[model samples]
Target: MTTPDVFMPRLPWDAVDPYPFYAARRREGDVVWDATAQAWLVLGHKVARNVLAAPHWISDPRANQAATAGRFFTADTVAANMLFTDGPTHDRLRHAVRDVFGHSFISQLTEGVESLCKQAISTIDVDEPFDVMSQIAWPLHVAVIAAWLGLDPAQCQVLREHSPAVIRLLSGITDTDTLHVGLAATTALITEFLPAAADRRAHPRDDLLSYLATAPELSLDEVVTTAILVAVAGHETTANLLGAALIRLITPTAEGTRLADHIDPADATVLTELLRLDSPVQAAARTATADQQLAGVHIRSGESVLVCIAAANRDPHVYPAPHQFLPGRPGPSPLTFGHGAHYCLGSALARLETSTALRHILERRPVLTATPAWRDTPAIRGPHHVPARFTA
Candidate 1:
């Protein structure tokens, strides 16, 4: 058995800035085998897409128990949702939730999302240096999602408090104890709400949860998991995107202002450009089902591969001036929201939330500009403390 050629480099965990590291990696080629991590790093746009779309590649960590055991995710909390499944299983769950979260359904929530954005923006301390992540981004997402689900306002606060811990775990920042606590809190939230929601379905209500409850094929466990997925995935991903987008907006660049001056707020293409430049979900891993060769590199069965979406988005050959943020840049969409069958279900909702939040910020606080203190997380990238002083 011949050992695969491996390009060993330290994981960019300690780097205050990882973009440069990713850039260096991308310069090497599309697929670089990482010997140290015992995984292949897919960095180019075409390669990442192929990797994501490949049927042979498995998203379920259980496929590679030894590699993912103590690192990527805890087996106990990994839900068998569409995100982790492939083929028929993914198709079933996706269809089950489609009516509730499809583009048309999510579009209906735009007005409510905008209202929540306005309300959240109104509370921002314009004169003081505020942590935008806490003051605006977090609250905006929490309020919009809670209202969409018809969750109690008080319970939304509990979700907010518990959510950061969950986000930490998802972002690969939490230890075992923290992960357990976060998972338990999240699971408990679902357990409490699912029963009431199930009852609400019998009576009928005009909310996302009620719509979800009506899914005939979905089990109680699936319902709970789905709801939990919405709560966590819906809010956290968009919150981070908002934070990242704000950082770009305030960075004192022509590209930033050009992006802010867009005519249509709901333009998915422009948002795609922004995401490509600064993706929130930076890396996602998958396991190989069988020994396969990609771009002339051998990937053994059961070994994990981490697709660097951020790096792939910036592949120079595919994207001109990849480092520069161009709102008008024309190209393929980024993989921030994973590609193929596992594309993010909450993608439309996320875009709506981000667009509304950005519009509110630009309209109310035109002079908003500041350097951001970025969060320490490998999986999700965002500003931890974005101090901005805005004048009305």
Candidate 2:
């Protein structure tokens, strides 16, 4: 197909800022069929939310118009997870481990998490720039998830090693060289977590891994896969969220006290605003189960819809001064964690982790002298490395 046919196969501003591209396209209409991705891109806040929660939208690409004859990377690695499944299968998996998100469960981790957060910040050399993504965000997330899973927190090194490749599995990078990385990541993660699940079964304890291992409702593979899901999914996205939030907070416009200063880290609104302004997972794909009208655009059955959460969060009609990060901004929640049936299972944990991390940093009062480099993935947004020099 010619350039005119694709209109812009790869968006021009993808490497840097893609918001202007989205805003320009959004001005034409809320949902438009883009030849680039060969999918309907939903940009309006209301319309995107509607599409996400709609009954006719499917999460799995194969369930649509047979988008691919086989899986994007390896057959079951990406396909077996609940994120791609819909209906009873999804519900069965979700219900099997829903208790992980309970208030009682999350509330118990506060003390331990707070200590870990402080410890993570303390390790940063007081005189030089430290990559917070490695020193602070990544380790803290791995530690929390590990502790909860009944695994030694020291094993975070494996997670640290494989996180990037595993992340690529979800970001839709399935080219030959990248697919090998994705496959290797998937194998390593499952290999590590499965044995732990078995050990949990052999020696039952008062922890999530043990509970899953013993749960009569789950198969052994389910226990292992779900544990891997919890361990992997629970932290990285949250790490990304915290990483992105930290970068934005460090350089809040030269106002008297930075929003990170006077604001209560635990305050939901503060996190909400931060999430809206710089979302971690910026885009998601949904397939149309049936023909539907979204913002007056006719969508055929078995077509794909790309829900641009980053764009929707900044919809001017829904949020005033959407581009600016205003911690005090009120009304309308951010869709960063999503909404409806598949809303993030780990959102509570993510919020608690981020709030704790930020509070600890502010107490130390470190001056970040340089900006962090943002991740290159088109859909997932966060710092691959957050460089900060600690100055007392």
Candidate 3:
């Protein structure tokens, strides 16, 4: 078969520099259709905000399930979770998770998250190059989230190991092999958590699993699915976020100032800017529930709308100089964690993990020991490895 002449941004897909493609898309229109993705790309920040608010745009793929839609779970079970639902169902699922993850509730995890960060950093030699994703971010996040859910950290490591396929599925990669891998990994994740859920039911503890397993509002399947969702969403994205920030913030730019030098552990503002520069989940798709208007374009009912978060986050109209990576700069919070009712419930937890991890490295002044290797995937953009050695 011959390759189709598609309109997707051709170049820079694998490059560390993806801004030029995003910049060119913004010049085209806020809502331009990409035949390659078979979805409309939303690149303007303000337009993206509006698209998020529009009620007719729904996250459930069943609304217009593509022929090749990924089977991340038995579709019925996974669709019941907040990440893939809408309206009252989404609200209910969000509420169940939110009660435990609310700002004040999650603040309690800060002490533990910090301790985990310290533990991770201690494993690396003072002046030795280490892969931050594995050595620092992944284990630190997995441990914190596992402790919060009242599970053993060692088992939680499996969730991280199987997370890349989840990212691929969520970001709209629906190839057969990718879908198979995602389903297998997802099954493994749920199987690992099943015993935990059962144990929580027999002896209810004052922890996340106990609450979830016993919640009257959630079905048994919902409980298992939600646990898998939280396991991946809670840690994987944040690990990528941490890796992205470290690669971009610690390295010296042509201007010679580094973002790490100015990071404040308690400052959400700096985290916001960094999120815009290096988004964790780069793209997502929503099917139109009804014929509607989005970004001045007439989106037909049942059509797939692809929200290019990495593109929207870099819109010049939103950020004064969208291409430059500057921490602590003034800009609205990024769409990386998403917006409206579908916004990530674990946003606060992820930010806390990232900022805390960043502060630990900053205090010691880490140096990038080698060129960073970015994950060469279009759906999720982040560094595969960021090797650094603290020079304090």
Q: For every model in order, what is the number of clashing pairs?
A: 0, 0, 0
A best-first ranking of the candidates according to their lDDT comes to 3, 2, 1
Q: Per TM-score, what order, best first? A: 3, 2, 1
lDDT, candidate 1, 1-392, per-residue tens: 22246332224533236688787776677888666455678888888899899878877755643332335454534554556667786688789877767889888788888788878778766576677788888888888888877788766877787776665544332344565676677666776677767786687688778777777877666666677678877887789888888766655654445445544545666677777777778777788888988777888888777788888888888889888766668778888887988888888888878887887787755444555677766667777877776676
- Considering summed lDDT, which 10 consecutive residues are worst modelled in model 2? 1-10
lDDT of 2 at 359: 81
TM-score of each: 0.87, 0.90, 0.92
Candidate that beats the other on TM-score, 2 or 3, i.e. the better one: 3
Using lDDT as the yardstick, the better of models 1 and 2 is: 2
* Distance from true location, Cα of 201 in model 3, Å: 1.6
lDDT of 1 at 228: 67
Cα misplacement distance, residue 202 of candidate 1 (Å) = 4.4
lDDT of 3 by residue, 1-392 (tens): 22355232211244466677767776778898766566787888887877776787887655544524433345676456777788888888878778777788788888888888889897777788788877887778788878878877557667777877776666544566666777778778878888888888778998788899898888777888898788777877888888888887788978898766766756777788888888877777788878887768898988877777888898887788777756667767789988898888888788788888888878778888889888766677778888888787
Top-scoring candidate (TM-score): 3
Q: List the residue pairs that clash in candidate 1.
A: none
Question: What global local distance difference test value does model 2 have?
Answer: 0.75
Clashing pairs in 2: none
